[model samples]
Target: MSTIQRPSRPCKECQRRKLRCDAQQPKCGLCQRARVPCEASPAGKRGPKRGHLDALRNRLVQLEETLQNRLDSEQHPQEHAQALHYSPGSTDASQSTDFLRGDVGYGDPLPQAFMLPGPSMAGDADTLGLGPFPFPDLAVSLPQIDRGTHAELDQLYFDRVHPSFPILHKRRYLNWSKSTAKSRSQTCLQQVMWILATLLSTQSRDLINPLYSRVKQDIDLIIMDTGPCQLELVQAWTLLTVCELMRALYGQAWASAGRMFRLLQGLRYHEIDSPRKDPVASEGMIDPIRTEEKRRVFWMAFLIDHLLSIRNRWPICTRLPISDHAFQAAQLGSSTFLSQAVTEPPSSDTCSFNECIIIATLSGRGLLRDVHGTISEAYGGSGQIHIDHDEWLNLVLATRNQALRQRNDSDRMGTFAQILGQVTEILFCKSLMTMNKNSSTESCTQEYRCRVLRAAEKIVLFAADLTALHFSMVHPFMFIPLFVTAEFLYENRALGDGAFLTQLRSLVDVFGQLTNVNDHERSYLDLLSRSCQQNIAIMPATTCVELKRIARDFLEALEDPNDPTKAQAVASADLSVTHESYPSTEGLEQFLSGWAKAKQFMPNFRMELVDMVAEVDASGSGGKVWVFSKVTGGGGGTDRDSIDMMSINGEGKVWKTKDVQRITSKH
Candidate 1:
């Protein structure tokens, strides 16, 4: 008969004494029989139970398999590593192991017998272990353990609590450990230092050392040198990017460092033209190549330091220092370097350098408006004297060309786009100021207004064309200046109102083109629209109707073929260029619809006729013409009337006793 396996019977003590007893426990009937006291013990408590035993067995089997595979690999050392696609997310164990073994493709496999040194381990090296590298200064020091002993938990109150986020202290240490490696922490520290350094340092060049040191450290962490050409190229590229970042930060600190902006460009020449003094190579090492790489990193930091100084624009002590002749000269030098970047074959080194220059230019523009009031006060009356249409065109063309032609070098091209915006803003502002000042001056003449108008028109048209051509890349930086110019032109009743409306209409029609691209053109377009609405809201209620009509008609024009040429005719031809266009029956209520609601809260709002006589009268005696609004009983009348338009003629008082001359309005 077949034997049937049944559950084990209860211990003999349970049968004889009528007490239940488990066979596997601290004590059972089997133990009692030996005169031992009985005690209960939980299952799987004393040692490895079934579950743990199974896990251990599996681990041992895996180890055995791994050992066998390793042995096979050692015997057949010539075996090639498997190449697999790497997704940023999912990774398998074999792939991970291969990565740890440095099995990444090295093209023409290195000899297996050659053993490269790794980060040091205990016993084989000193307390501060030395690597195989020759340069002691370049060697990175590991984070040190605190030397202090008997540290109380109270001392860690500050350590446990993050100053930026105190609530973080409530979480356990293990909970926050996963986030300690965040790049944001590094960025935050750098930003704090950057702001402090810019504010504290009186001399632009004085901040260079600290900036360069940080940049060098960053490069050391990111750059990996495995070969001669590849190492040199990457190092060069890193240096160039550092230079660009430094340059971007330069004009913000001090104007004096404007001269130093050229230093990075010159330094590039030094690094590239220097004699190729090859270092001695050691077996199983890339020491010689690494030395060159370090030099490249050092030079990059040096370049970045000066560039940052220039960006801060501290020396010039003016907003948008780019307008200064000296600043412009420095800009020209920067542009020269950027223009030179594209003509050469771009390696990793070349690409980064190009990027650096572009970023510097963009960053420098941020400092422009800081000096706006000073520039306006100093050169406000200079009118058409400062207009340079050709120069403006050149800057526009250069930037647009750089952005398009050097698409691969975005950092540099992006910087160029920013510089273009700055230069354009300065010109646009100067033109707007002239138009505002010349509005009422009979001596100013239509010829002068028209001349200024012509310049504004050309800039707007050029910007519009450039916007379409490189919308994906150039739009973000292009928007502010372009829209600012558009607003200014619209206020002056200049040529571009028609053109801008037309271009905008075309853009709206083909809006789909701006989508699905890497560029952030939509942000710029939105900024422009918002800005336009704000400026439009401040116009007289009568003009509101015509403005709305123009806006609506332009939007309507989008329904037509999105050809810019056709849109221009439709939008431009619709705007009434004559004085009759003013005082449209459409009131402020309709116009504000296109504007942001926050603008309605403005304390003062006025829209007056553009007059020329008032400007000449005020400007002739070194006074400023101010526009005023009057409330009429019949219809709300908004007209230009100058008040307090005289300067104190070497006197401390308001000087109201002078002859009050009234300039008649011809309109």
Candidate 2:
């Protein structure tokens, strides 16, 4: 250099002395003065060392190798099953080091073809393999269940799940699943469907945990990366909601259902009756099968929204249209709802799906849950504290009857529908009973109690039929109905005949069967069963028989309700309606007075026992309850139901004054 520019970096000797560098490099003042040999350069390199890229490259190489193995396995997928479905492998967290770093899983000996590797990031992120969504790794994490396990699951799904929920088209889905190729969204669908199948098949947390966790981890990324307009995505989301419910992930289930509903709105599925050329009409070309699928898909979301509301008593995401015809048509096409839903469509069992819709709508409209302050406001309700009980009962029965009219010759779907319909009726009946517990007449209270018992019994018997047929045929939603029935039975067990505890325990046994699928159900079942066993009281056979005798005699006394003298003679010993004049059945006593009053107000009144409950007393003290469905003569067949509960002390042989509770005016 011309003047030997002063070196900016210090020499080794200067650094050791912690002094400034001199103008020259060969000899420095600090080294010379300290009598230390000076080094030519500094102790370290000119710049900081870089070890990050090296470590990253090593990781990249590992991923590439594992991906290559997966690729090789995918080519020969039939040979992929080197071991049985997830061979008993160690799931111990301490052995996690043995786990793969990708979607293959923690400790499962899963087939390598489950996961496929995405393209490596090139020079630019814009050119990444993920189409229109720069998330190159989103689709890669999806794990396609192995062919063998998938085949088993496919059979299981169509055989068991499909009968209850026939949302997917069978032949098309089977063909698609069998093929080696699937789009990004279809891949997502496969993964979620597999997750549901796994949960339904095995109770082993070992298998469910890994697959479920992987889906949960990658599914959000896929949904976010691949925007949610696809029908397959909607189906996947719905299935995921079911999965969350099975595992008792309530919060997550709610969120998943909510997201799916929004996706549905985005796809414009909610505009069922819109005049505009909506998403279904693409440039004046309509796909019939696809359109039917869209309707089923929308109805599926509708079903979930209502189920969520029913299960937790929460506000539904999408409010039902005020129009009944529109709502029913939207649920199942007008033609389908009329022909298939009511009569039996050769094409599909839409009645089952419509039946579920009916229950969902009933729960919200009937206001079964205690938390209806906000929900009431949404649907033009007065948002008042006291619900109009008559209006509530009317809505309930109307919905129930409409759903009941849905007939399927095949019980595969019909059984589930019947169970749900009865379950809903039971829920509404219980709510009515609870509302009128103390302030109302004993007879009125007992009428609702009888209704509750009848509905509960029907549900248990239907579930019994399902169990007998095959538990797999039961809907996944059956779990909710089962719990609801069990709880209602226990709460109102004292209202039953001598068979009170018998019915309750029958449902308890069904609860235990849920353990065959998983243990979560057993936890709640134990709590309910324990409570029932500890507190439940069974009515005595004598009291039940006596009450039945009293009911029969009362009906016999009023055999000619039209005749005044016969009505007056109801309490006579000759009539045998009440054997002992000292302890007369109140039903017999009220006959003359009610008939006389009926003649006074509206002439020629006719009455019969539409429904009856013999034993209303848990102490077996002999309390009589009967539900009289009133039919007004000469008035165009106006059908209505009422309850006349009579309080009688069998032990003391004394009659107490009771009032009539008119439950519903008309169906």
On TM-score, the candidate that comes out on top is 2
- Model 2 earns a TM-score of 0.50
Tens-digit lDDT track of model 1 for 1-667: 4533323554433432233454655346455564645443323236533354565566567667655655554453232111111233453566446534645332222222221222221123232232222122233221111222102221232232121111111122223323446342233233223322232222223334454454444433222222212222233233234233323332322322222233223223223222332223321135322332233333343334433333332222111101112221222111223324423333333333334434344334423433453466687633333336434443543454354344533332333333343434345345444445636754544444444454444444444444344332332223334445545544544334344343333333232222212122222332333345455322211221222223323333333322444335323222221122123223223222322232334324332212111221221111222222221121123333322222211111112111133233345
Give Cα-based local distance difference scores for all models: 0.33, 0.52
Candidate 2 ranges beyond 4 A from true positions: 1-62, 65-146, 178-181, 202-207, 226-228, 278-285, 310-350, 368-412, 438-440, 493-502, 519-667
Give the worst 10-residue stretch by lDDT in candidate 2: 113-122
Write the residue-wise lDDT of candidate 2 on 505-622 in tens digits.
5665555334334443232343332223333222212244334434444445554555645434223322212322123334444545544454455454455444456554665455
Instruction: Return the TM-score for each candidate structure.
Output: 0.26, 0.50
Candidate 1: regions farther than 4 A off: 1-311, 314-475, 494-523, 529-667
